[model samples]
Target: MDIRLDDLTHPAIHALLEEHMAGMRALSPPECVFALDLDKLRHPSISFWSAWDGDTLTGCGALRELDAGHGEIKSMRTPNALRRRGAGKAILQHIIGVARARGYQRLSLETGAPAGFAAAHALYLGAGFVETGPFGDYQEDPFSRFYTLAL
Candidate 1:
């Protein structure tokens, strides 16, 4: 699989992001769903990427600079058919690499606390992220679990 920066305009990437947002909405309350929409993902501080296997889109992920020394992971998603195929892991590892290259000292993310998020929790944990309290603009929310990795 090859991963590269994405402009978020490709039909496949658009559809994937829509599916990701839909899944988030189904798993968490509207207010608790923090997944970024396409517009938000286009922010200057954010770097979005898509993973592909030749002509097929496998997954996507993004990194957003929160401060000079910190960054946040956003919009990570892999299709059901691609789950456990290393697509998500590749995108995550790519994001971590970019964060490190940007001189970030820490990388953080916020995911849902529901059972549906177990796989996500495991993925982050396996990638060396540790459970932590809210960071950046986030506040205490029982429905959210935060994780951070010190680079």
Candidate 2:
């Protein structure tokens, strides 16, 4: 698989993001949902990527710069067809590499804390992220679980 910077408008990427947002909405209450809309991910501080296998988009992920030494992971999603096929791992490794290259010392992410998100929580933990308190604009919320890793 190849991972590269991408415009969020890429149809495949957009579809994957939409699915992820839908999952978030379904799994959490409206007020507790914090999925970034496309507009938010398009901000200057965010860098998005799409992972592909030849002509097929396998997954996507993004890193949002929080400061000179910190970043946040966002919009990480693997296509349904590509789930459990190493797509998510590839995208995550790419995100970590990019964050390191960008001089970020730490990376934080917010994900659902419910049973529905167990796989995601496990994935993050296996990737070296540890449970953490809120970062950035986030506050304590029963609907969310936060994780952080030192890059």
Write model 1 residue lDDT over 1-151, tens digit each, in one string: 9998999899999899889999999998999999999999999999999999999999999999999999999999998777999999999999999999999999999999999999999999999999999998898787899999999
Tens digit of per-residue lDDT, candidate 2, span 49-149: 88899989988888999999999999888876678889888889889998899899999999998998988898999999999999999999999999999
Off by over 4 Å in 1: none
TM-score of 1: 0.98
Candidate 1 lDDT score relative to the true structure: 0.94
For model 1 the local lDDT of residue 147 reads 100
The Cα error of candidate 2 at residue 129, in Å, is 0.7
Q: lDDT for each of the candidates?
A: 0.94, 0.90
List where candidate 2 sits over 4 angstroms from the true fold: none
Give the best candidate by lDDT. Answer: 1
